[model samples]
Target: MGLLFLTIFLTDFFGYTDALLRFDRVRRKVWMFVGTRSPIELDWDRLTPVSQGITPANSNVNTFRSVLLVDLDAEGDVKFDGKYPRIASIGQTSLNEQQAISQYEYVRQFMELGPTHLPSCETYLEHRTVFRDIVRFFGFLDLARNIDWRRPGETGGGLLVLASILCMLLGWAFLPFDLATYIAYRCNRVPKWPAKIEAYAKDGGEMTTPVGAASGRMRIVLKEVPFILLWVGCAFAVYAWVASWFIK
Candidate 1:
């Protein structure tokens, strides 16, 4: 049992850390692509380039394309031409300047409307906050609250606690079965008893009536059996260790 605990502690600790690092790296890449300092300030304008090409139909009329010009720098500057020239200002109302303005306006609107109808900064921040919250919640739910046998603080402190507990459990017991059940629980596989009760209450009907009651009762056995096995294994291991010492 001691050996099992040790094994479980090591594997779970390292595996969880590895997974977290991988997630962090992917998140960073996503932020980088979106032109945000963190996941919190994504500005679409900074990420996407303004349009410079003119439509085939508008090619004949230089003024027509010029009329579509947009002022990106807010100084009424930054003009575009057929060559897509990057210039300082859109001076003098000409066909080229108009075209540049049009392109800028088009790109600006596109950025503004994309990504949940939020500005670059707001969108990025919202997404980051949501992502962080979800990950944190699940980490707590899976690693902190749900244990097969051991207590919460049995594992090391900090982020290692979850990993350590996981390792210890896996090393000392038949972890595959326990792990499957844990997964199911996290996925909310339990039947709809709560929904049924709420419906009855709303209708002024018998709120005590069971809805999906049979399914919930049946799943309890599957949910609890692993914890029992874990406890029994741990106890037997402790007894054997003490017995060995006496023999020696």
Candidate 2:
């Protein structure tokens, strides 16, 4: 069962990489690169944006998604200059309508008004290193980066702060799962853009610079080490107790 799940997980992860949509804000165009097919190009303005709520049958669970569709025929097939894919779906699904709209708006703003008009966000590029993977796997870096010992009362009082700490630290109980996630991420293939797309990306735009760890964050991470170790030990103890029943 575990091997079956691993296969499914890898398939789902890599299968999505077979195709990709590339947006060129400077050229005001959208490019679709499907499996072994020639690249399809379309004017950004001609595309229709749709935001929808999706729900599976007999389930209350619903998700919101956004897609950019273009040049549809009577049968709802996509065509570009009469030679392209029959249909294509662009953009990712979100948890809510607002989130779905936000995803669309993010692309729209960039394509319509350039990258300068887009919302600002912190960006980082992590090299594929074992140390980086391990820290990220256990969320040690995030916990370290976001921790503010001096301003514990910023969000709420001491009780609320304590509750947040407990909740975040609870993730440590899933050490095995985190390890599996780390391994998958390390082994996952990183997508490389086509030479044409790469050149286009560098044509003319204000690129976002990747930032590194903030000053003194390593010190903060040191403080969190003991807590993570304690939780890991506890998790192992519980695991050993549970396995003893079947082991012998």
Which predicted model would earn the best lDDT?
Answer: 2
Clashing pairs in 2: 78-86
After superposition on all CA atoms, what RMSD does each candidate show versus the true structure?
A: 23.6, 4.8
Per-residue lDDT over 16-51 for candidate 1, one digit per residue giving the tens place of the 0 to 100 score: 211110011111211111111111222232233333
lDDT of each: 0.35, 0.59
Where does candidate 1 stray beyond 4 Å? 1-204, 208-235, 246-248
lDDT of 2 at 25: 78
Q: For residues 148-218, could you state the per-residue lDDT of candidate 2 as single tens digits? A: 66884554345434633563455445566667655665655555657887799888755645344232213
Please give me the total number of clashing residue pairs in predicted model 1.
Answer: 15
